[model samples]
Target: MKATHQPPTHAPVTTADLLRMAALYLRQHGWTQGTYYATTTPTNYPTPPACAAGAIGIACAGHTVEHFTQLDPDTLADYLATLAAFVDHLDTAYPMFLIDDDGFALDEHTSPYSWNDDPARTAEQVITALEAAADESDQLHLTGGQN
Candidate 1:
């Protein structure tokens, strides 16, 4: 008799989940904390706020780092969405220096694969991948000047 093969299972990646994952990534990279709000701007804020208020925001060491509105559909439907773009921006700006899920450091000289085709991947998976890369980056930073 032959055994049956089964595919892995993953929960749907909700907007809240994405937000939490992003916050975790930010914290891992030295961001202090994050806040979530229902409106883009707080009603009681004075003019010229230090940071633009949004549905979600994160700060690092008392400095505002990021602020953005919520994702539509409450789920990550495509890589072209704002949240994904934000992640890309963070990766580029801060150099999370992530290795691939397979434990291979992504070649800085090469382009990464477009995630548009695999929108079904869960937020947890994405965070895990990023965290692994960040860990590697931290190790490299601690051991040598390379990053």
Candidate 2:
């Protein structure tokens, strides 16, 4: 007998899920520096992979990393604005989580885009950062926030 695959139940897709998908995208497609993606479009998978922020943008595009596709501007903006995804961005409520290129919160506000493009940045570092953000989001959602 053959079995069919079932779809994921998370209909609305949370910030944590978006972050995790970004990490998965980096793991599977490799990583890039100096660009959100070599191609920078959800309609097409990036070549030579995507930067940390780029991965996040790709994640914002679809339900899954492998199937990421174009999302309307408003929808994409909504994903990018999620508190978890904002951890590394500037001037957000998460100033404490704003980190430098080294992924440390040195009281310096470095955007994820700039951090990902740093010459010294590694793919592992970027991927790990995304996963960490997801974990934090998970904890927040489980402990004190609405899903």
Candidate 3:
């Protein structure tokens, strides 16, 4: 007798729902590759100059499953809006002058910094890039490995 493996079934869902499911799946499966953490402070860099004293901000990160899934347009828009709002709030509330993958606040840029000028716009741009990547991933999945 031969064993049969079944592929996971994922129904059409919202981006938020998919994100939640991915998070849950990663946690349940103990998949460390998809998991990540960001620090509000400059932990990756050296102290003092690189990291200002008492500079604090929010650390946000998430993981996506290996499976490719289409994102509901409305949900994706909502998620992007929420992210923009959060970034705007953080920019207004904190003295965050620097931002990186590690969420570190390193040396402050000189005047006329692009990100400092408009954090919300920057956040939106970031979300847009991510959305494009997601779309590509979905396409690749649909095509069965062709990127």
lDDT tens readout by residue for model 2, 1-147: 336867767667778888888889889987888866665545553344777766777777643243223656676565656533556433333233455798878655546666667677788877877887777677767744575
lDDT of 3 by residue, 1-147 (tens): 336866669764433333333333323332211112223334453221100001110111122211112334654454444344334433544434755779886654322123333435342342333344344335434543354
Answer with 1 or 3, whichever has the higher lDDT. 1
**Worst 10 contiguous positions by lDDT, candidate 3:** 50-59
Candidate 2, which segments miss by more than 4 Å at Cα?
Answer: 1-10, 39-48, 63-74, 82-108, 143-147
| Candidate 1 Cα lDDT to native | 0.35
Per-model TM-score versus the true fold: 0.27, 0.63, 0.24
- List residue ranges in candidate 3 displaced over 4 A: 1-70, 99-147
Worst 10 residues of 1 by lDDT: 47-56
* Candidate 3 clashing pairs, residues 3+ apart or interchain: none
**Ranking, lDDT, top scorer first:** 2, 1, 3
The residue-by-residue lDDT of candidate 1 on 1-147, one tens digit each, is: 336766558854433343444446443432211222223455543221221111123321122323222333332242224244444444654344447999987754222223211345343444454454444434444433354
Model 2, position 135: C-alpha lDDT score: 78
TM-score of 1: 0.27
Better of 1 and 2 by lDDT: 2
